[model samples]
Target: MTTESLAEPTMRVRPGWTVAVVLANVGVFAAWFGPIQVLLAKQSEALAPDNKEFVFGLVTGIGAAVSVVAAPIWGAVSDRTTSRFGRRMPWTLGGALGAAAGLLVLSGAQGVALMLVGWCLVQLFGNAVLAAQTATVPDRVPVEQRGVVGGWVAVAQVPGALVGTALATVFGGIAVGYIACAIFVVLSVLPYVARAQDARLVVAPAFVLRDFLRGFWISPRRYPDFGWAWLTRFLFNVGNSIGLLYLFYYLQDEVGVPDAGTSVLVLTAIYSVCTLVTAIAFGAWSDRLGRRKIFVVASGLVMAVAAVVLAFWPTWPGAVLGAIVLGIGFGVYLSVDFALITEVLPNAVDRAKDLGVINIANSLPQVIAPVIAAPIVKHLGGYPVLYLLSAVITALAGVLVGKVRSVK
Candidate 1:
């Protein structure tokens, strides 16, 4: 069916379609987070033991910078696509393949330059897949069901991270771990691409360079809800990124964990289980109650509490408790907030592009987090100060959610 028939997205998506989307996301997140959680740190340490933190931050920050540009451009391109297969399908398939190629490059990298190159490729293409997938929720799912569907999709993140970390840990070497992630990403995305009934753009929109450029600048004055939603998401992610970016080091340096990698896996497992439970349950509850703002506010506050726990306690038990609390908070926030954002999109014609712009909120934090975190860990009151800052930012994100007047 063409997009003209799906202008309002009233039809409820089938369970099979939901499952496919979830699996594809699982793969994408696995490939992305595996390196973030384990492989990259290990590689950086090997390349520059004394300066692993700097190298890790640089590589990830630059990679996130690439994603900042790639997602919206790819989304806009997909918005104008007129492929026989579908608008989103071609890009989704191409992105997964390109990301896999990037992973292959990473698997063989011997120097920092090559490593940087490989990671940038992964981010560039990975965002394409993410952009297309994110848009599909609004394109296909009905409003009433979005919370539950978004919850299911949101829950994929934890499992994906877990799977990736486990693979990286089980595989041992960096090359083997990267290769495993590459294979998993390709395999996971295939089912979605093969089965998806994406909207086909029969006639491409008229391309006006000036108009196209203007489209990117969504005026906050015209769309206050979108602007507020964007800002809140950005703040929450900033807090999250700062909290997580230095976890490997935190475990080793502060907690004094002997085997940091395995500890990360364990914490992730606890976090995953909690997230899986809350994401689906809270999402369904939001849908049932037809309220989005309350859940978002509550979750953000909960996350802030979790960060505070880690800030003060600084023990293995503290990390575990923090993970559980953070997972619950994140699960609820991720699913419900996604539903809220979809409700606030400025225009349906540019769903993918708008989501991509919103995604900048997600990626930009990664870029800035390193800049923010490195100094705090190095100079300030160390991890304690970092966590306190995270708490403050996260709590503010929750307070700001009340400004998104459109959804609730």
Candidate 2:
């Protein structure tokens, strides 16, 4: 279990098809989230309207909420799907197509409701890719190799978020940003479908909805570390969500940076470049070291410290430094945390479904954080309080991660 011994397996862990799936998401995100609406005055006016911040928030929430249901259902569907391309591939392909359609719909959305509907669809079917893809780590990769692949998946986000954010900001147009995101999503995933071998029918059981729901409770109680792992994932993502979801707004409010096209591009470039490099390095290093929890703990602590710095300082320089810390911490966490989860499953038989439950940890916290954050920020006064609160949650999350002794 020592780092040196662990490192060999983790590093040698071929990403196989999972990395390809991650790439598809990158492309999809770039197209959907990227700036696609620069050309249309009407679209821009509504999206960035003088008085529709609430609407925008609502649209976003709707999108997030839609995924709650989508994720589980997609996981179930993949569980049921027994196809020639493999269960994961069919869903990955279908999810990509759904994502493409969703983006196309979003491109044409004319009103708040239409926008919400389009984004909801995108969030739902678009995220189906995750249900199929995440299970691949546990299903196919050796436990030791999981960390390296997780790193690959995590680093993929650099292009996924940064590239898309850049396109959206630079284009300053609605339709173009969206269409571009669709393209990115498709391109990123193609390699995964082509290269990854179908997982042999491993321990993952055939789907039975009734048993699956029961499996959630049965596994955690039976496997001590699985429960802790899920808790840690949820808490970690929650803390991370607070920092990432709000970073841009913090820049605008704290530094008084205008939300101009130029400013956004600069920020995305800086953030993406720093984060991508750190994320990939740390992910690989963690696998080599054969220690995932320490990195997870380190990620939480870094984020907490960055939150504190941002809370009190609120200057352009301070924000930049915070972003750097945040980037490194988050990148490492995203890259390696999945490895930790894969290590602790009760048994391999339920890998997909069990992993599905853990996947909820990633999604659910996203739902929980903004609801808690926006209210706290509103009541407590400003970005400082939000940062303070995020820091505390992050520290707590790090502690929860320590609860897992069995994973090692």
lDDT winner: 1
**Per-residue CA lDDT of candidate 1, range 1-408, in tens?**
255623978889999999999998888899899999999999999999999999999999999999999888888888888898777888888898999999999999999999999999899998898898888888889999999998888678889999989888887899999999999988998899889888777888789999998888889999999999999999999999999998989998999999888999999999999999899899999999999999999998999999999999999999999999999999999879999999999877888889999999989999999999999999988999999999999999999999988787
Q: What would the TM-score be for candidate 1 when compared with the true structure? A: 0.98
List TM-score per model, in order. 0.98, 0.86
State model 1's lDDT. Answer: 0.91
Best by TM-score: 1
- Report how far off residue 189 is in candidate 2 (Å): 1.7
Q: lDDT per prediction?
A: 0.91, 0.67
Off by over 4 Å in 1: 1-6
